[model samples]
Target: MMHRQRGVGLVEVLVAVLLLSVAVLGFSALQIRAVSATDESLVRTKSMTLVRNLSEVMRAYPEAYVTVSGTTFVTAAASDAGAVPTIQAVISGSATNTVKVDSDDISITGTDSCLSTGIKTVDDKKVAKQACSINQLAARDALMVKKIATDEDIKVNVTTCPGTTTQAIQTQMCVITAWNSTKAILDDDDEKACADSNGIYKSGSQCLISEAY
Candidate 1:
């Protein structure tokens, strides 16, 4: 029999430690990726919810988006129309195309007046609760969008659907949402761009486009 084997060799102990460290590092990387994916999915869900709310409001007040000579939809003539202004963009990359509603304008009192206090009846000599105009309703709708976007910390861009022109009043509208992420930003000429000049989305971008008729 040999005199006796030492408890363990230094080389063997160092190799075991190295192997454990490698395994731990690999697991850590996987955990990080999972967390990132989960976060992105949550943001996408929030974006979808915002789009749904906006679509419902638009459908409820169809007259708010008046058709101009059976062609394009235009806002009615009203002072509050300026509150929900839309900037027509020739290209999808135009920064001005993005319309962010001012959260500061959100006030229950301000909207209450727009809802039920404006027209006074001379015959009754009392303030009659008048129905909100299409313009006022539209302004309210925009504010709702602003509130949601602010809460979600995202950006929204509303425009006519891609490959379709505003020449037709019935053209589908697109609600595009984007947030800060590791993925590529919305741009042109890049394979990873979120949206092209036509407002169509590509893979690998952190953006979601929802279309509503």
Candidate 2:
């Protein structure tokens, strides 16, 4: 008679089943979170690898600055303003140019003109000039890789004060205007070609080359 009572209890069995279900659910949740984390890590790793590869290519051709579509890549020139120059390279996948890394953009920025001891009155002009120079250099390098001619009607315009002042006076004001071939293309089409690249001038997936005059 006592053995019969000890056989099983319905309430106990139900509680055991509920506990097992909870454990299974927790494990499933843990597995899903792990998978999501792994996928995100993989994406970041791929982005880093892409940037590294581009840097290696640019380093190989130190003198050359290249761009595809709207992306421009070039080395930045040094300036006395103690600004850190930046270089960028971008690549996008394409079915036609799988190995080519088709959509590429590169840009370079000269030193900053806003340093504490730099030009005070007007530094924007100097920065603009530097940016123009970098853009031209990038266009020239890009042409070398492709059949595009970068020198069709190049123009360099600078807006400066009527009278130039010495560095000590700090009254000079000017702006540099140059033909930005890559920018022109992007502006004309209103579409960015270089969505990914290395550097500091990224604007909503587009690379920009800018500096304070």
Candidate 3:
């Protein structure tokens, strides 16, 4: 009697190939997703590191170096040669003796002078003899000083005198006035956002079980 050849049918072979294709496709998708997640995480970590480095540079500088112009401290790169960097201080207000009316409805006036008056007598006899002379000299020196308006509303007055002796004086003044009827400009939002989206991982075939025979 001739025995019938036993072998997998063409249909069975095709089914097996289809199943294998499906499994391979699923694994490929999983691999692609995992790679994307890892890339996103790396980008976020880099951004965080950059921000941290900037913060460290800022911390090394003194608080006096910070200036508030319109509710923000303008920052620049540090120039220090040491491990801790340094930032230069910027003058926020108007020039040395200038006045400015800011958008915040505030008016500021500054005054500067190079010469002031003080008495230095050479001796008791000179003091007694120059008491009256010094008074007249002080008045004359005051009249000789030049006054210049540095700004539209700011003024600078300078005085100088060269006698048989030498004396030095300096003065600076700044005044800020808020416009009572207007509101000052305010900065409410001063923060950075996350650099990128968070990464995610989904369950794959490894999480499932095989059928039992």
Candidate 4:
């Protein structure tokens, strides 16, 4: 009888340890999820702020920032031409207006006349600072985007909201933003939520889509 009691006590100890181990594992998983959620929240906030900044800048300089050329929207980079960060926007309406932003746009070399110290020598050898041209101001804003986007692969797209008719696409612009994250947040089947045939955001994408009128 004594031996049987001892065996039962030992079994109880083992079972208790097993239960504790399971509990610890569950707690660890919860902690990981919490951290992931927090990080994603931060990313979303940053992305929204960045996209809004760009949208506001575009609005401020509508004529220079983007011009509707036939069926496409286009702009040029005149400041910090070497910077490589680019943003693409599409105006979807009667025609798909594609905007391709890259270094191929106009690059202003030599002293930037937009600066206070920039002086251009005219034909009469007179030197004076000139106000920033509309294109130059737009380029400066683009350069700002390039600088802010450093260290992260950021992509922006302007599209019609899902399920919205093409006719209304011109009035509403959906600014979709995505950047790099530690791990993939997109499910294998849900790639279309953040990306499409136009382009793909970086792997481990944290994406946010904001609509602007």
Candidate 5:
């Protein structure tokens, strides 16, 4: 009887050790996943802040994106086959041409200094300081974002606003200041990563689009 009890004790001890091992491994995996998620979240927050900042910065430059009056607003038709049913309830009076007035895409992209007579044109104001033109500003913004995104092996592209595939709206313009690089942060080349399809990224290229601002 004594020998049998000792064998049973050994078996119980072995089972306990096995359970402990599994628990340790599970905790370790949990920790790794949590850390990864947190890192991704940080990237998203930073990207969003950058997007908003650029919008406000561009807002300071009215000439860069000043909308003309009597322009139509972008709209979706109710009966359109491509319209998403889940979100179509918001489309009012479908079947007619939806108008988007005062909407203008940034037409230029370059590094040419738009300075005049020692005064720099920046953020819609002419100042006695070194500055960039609207085109230059857009280029620099794209470059800076690319630098930030690439530090993590991510790529970024800043194309002219108003995606090339979509038709232009006839009404008022919506100012899209910048596109952040966090969209492709995961190295995923998914379409939602950026508003423009022509600038698809491969692996760690975050595509941030400014839809409104």
Candidate 6:
């Protein structure tokens, strides 16, 4: 009778082990889903910030955006055109642009573009905040975005169609901004509204759309 009781105890232990294994597997799956959701949220937030930042930059400096047809400024680090650190966007008049992401320089912008104009002041006040170069503002904005985005691909697109901006000088610029975070999980049709059929990247990355002139 003692031997029979020992065998029954062993069977009970085996059943408990099997149940524990199943519970662990279920917990692991839930953990994975939570992590993936967090990643998606982070990617979307960062990407949207970049888009809004760029639009504000352009709206603040209308002159620079028009002249950005061939200006290739460094978008990362404290580097200029020739002093570029590694690689960055080559700003142009094209509709689409690609920029590398970095999260190491948050306070890289906010420099007064009109910081050197003591040429002639009012009664005695120094006219330092006169007018900053358009290119300078654009560069500052791009750098801020680079710092916000870490190891992500940011795509910017400007659409000036079906709109009109009557300018005293230069062509009309009814500009619109559309940006995409390629690293995020998005539907294929999300970016469709921003580009033509040929411009699509075919990657299902949700696009946060905004418009500014």
lDDT of 2 at 93: 11
Candidate 2 stretches greater than 4 Å from native: 1-8, 65-213
Please write out the lDDT profile of model 2 over residues 40-144, one tens digit for every residue.
Answer: 566445434433433343344333323333332333333223212122222221111111211222222223211123333355543322223433443323233
lDDT on C-alpha atoms for all candidate structures: 0.55, 0.32, 0.26, 0.50, 0.39, 0.43
In terms of lDDT, the poorest run of 10 residues in model 1 is: 88-97
- Can you give the TM-score per candidate against the true fold? 0.66, 0.33, 0.29, 0.58, 0.45, 0.51
TM-score of 6: 0.51
Q: Which candidate number has the best lDDT?
A: 1
**Best candidate, TM-score:** 1
Error of 3 at 39 (Å): 0.8
On a 0 to 1 TM-score scale, where does candidate 5 land against the true structure? 0.45
* Shift in Å, residue 38, candidate 2: 2.2
State the lDDT of candidate 1 residue by residue for 1-213, as single tens digits. 233655557679999999999999999999999999999899989988887887776566544433122112245432333212221111112221122222112133353334554567777776646554554455456555655676678776666666774422235767677777522234567775568867667766688877776
Determine which window of 10 residues in candidate 6 has minimal summed lDDT: 86-95
Stretches of candidate 4 off by over 4 Å are 65-131, 159-171, 181-206
- Scored by lDDT, model 5 comes in at 0.39
Superposition error at 119 for model 6 (Å): 7.9
C-alpha root-mean-square deviation, each candidate = 7.2, 18.3, 25.9, 9.1, 13.6, 10.0
Ranking by TM-score: 1, 4, 6, 5, 2, 3
Model 6 has a clash total of: 3
lDDT of 4 by residue, 57-139 (tens): 65665544343343233454323232111222222111221122332232223333254665777896857555555545555
lDDT of 4 at 126: 56
Q: What is the lDDT of residue 136 in candidate 2?
A: 43
